[model samples]
Target: MSSPTTYHLVRPHVVTEIPTLDEHQQQVVDHAGGPLLVLAGPGTGKTTTLVEAIVRRIDDGAPPTRCWR
Candidate 1:
């Protein structure tokens, strides 16, 4: 028998200009997209991040109608 010695994690979000993420919130913001479902308890900034992502997409030249926001 053996015991695992280590754990590995990859911080999901790569913030382009935003200075910092509160480590905890980084993963939440990162997993905000794609053809998947996200569900969790309250007090998470899920809605806020979604809005931020949409705004970022638009800022980065994605046309209004082209953005999935």
Candidate 2:
């Protein structure tokens, strides 16, 4: 008789820190709903703002998969 193999699944630890948002950035992050358009020049924190907004949505019980889409 052959013995069954055992497998262990482990999730890696990840450290994510939210950066401080400026006044305009905060407004965008706090937007309730509707089509929002962001226009800014270079060196602005557009990517950061987007990421934090998505994080906030996920924190508010939104599905991670939906957030990505």
Candidate 3:
């Protein structure tokens, strides 16, 4: 069988909070099959958004080894 594609966390940062994504953020989080760039200022929930994104991937069954190196 073919190996599933991988998803990479945008950057390396510990996720401490239970991230909750809104509709727009959820859109970005779900688009984990390719390059994604979230450009915005600080305190705009970048980490929260990213955490949700990663969590979603894990929830879908991707392992750590399959993610970014």
Candidate 4:
């Protein structure tokens, strides 16, 4: 007779620091609806603002799959 093998699953603990948004970035992050166009030069935190907005939506009960990229 052979003994069954035991398997264990472990999830890694990740720590992420959220950045503070400036006035304009905060505006974009807080926009409720309608088409929003963000025009800015490179290194202007555009991606950061977009990501924060998406995270905010998800935190507000928006589904991950339905969240805008």
What lDDT does each candidate get?
0.62, 0.88, 0.74, 0.91
lDDT of 4 by residue, 1-69 (tens): 898999888988989799999999999989998899989999999999989999999998899988764
Best of the candidates, lDDT: 4
- Residue pairs clashing in model 3 are none
Give me candidate 2's TM-score against the actual structure: 0.70
Q: What TM-score, computed on C-alpha atoms, does each candidate reach?
A: 0.44, 0.70, 0.61, 0.73
Count the clashes in each prediction: 0, 0, 0, 0
Q: Give the Cα-based TM-score of candidate 1 against the true structure.
A: 0.44
Model 1: lDDT of residue 63: 94
Badly placed stretches (over 4 Å) of model 1 are 1-33
Model 2: per-residue lDDT, tens digit, 15-65?
A: 977698999999998987788999998879999999989988899888998
Evaluated against the true structure, the overall lDDT of model 3 is 0.74
In candidate 3, what residue range of length 10 has the lowest lDDT sum?
60-69
- Inter-residue clash pairs, candidate 4: none
Model 1 — which ten-residue stretch has the worst lDDT? 18-27
Candidate 4, 13: how far from true, in Å?
Answer: 9.8
Q: What stretches of model 3 exceed 4 Å from their correct place?
A: 1-19
Query: How do the candidates rank by TM-score, highest first?
Result: 4, 2, 3, 1
Candidate 2 — worst ten consecutive residues by lDDT sum? Answer: 60-69
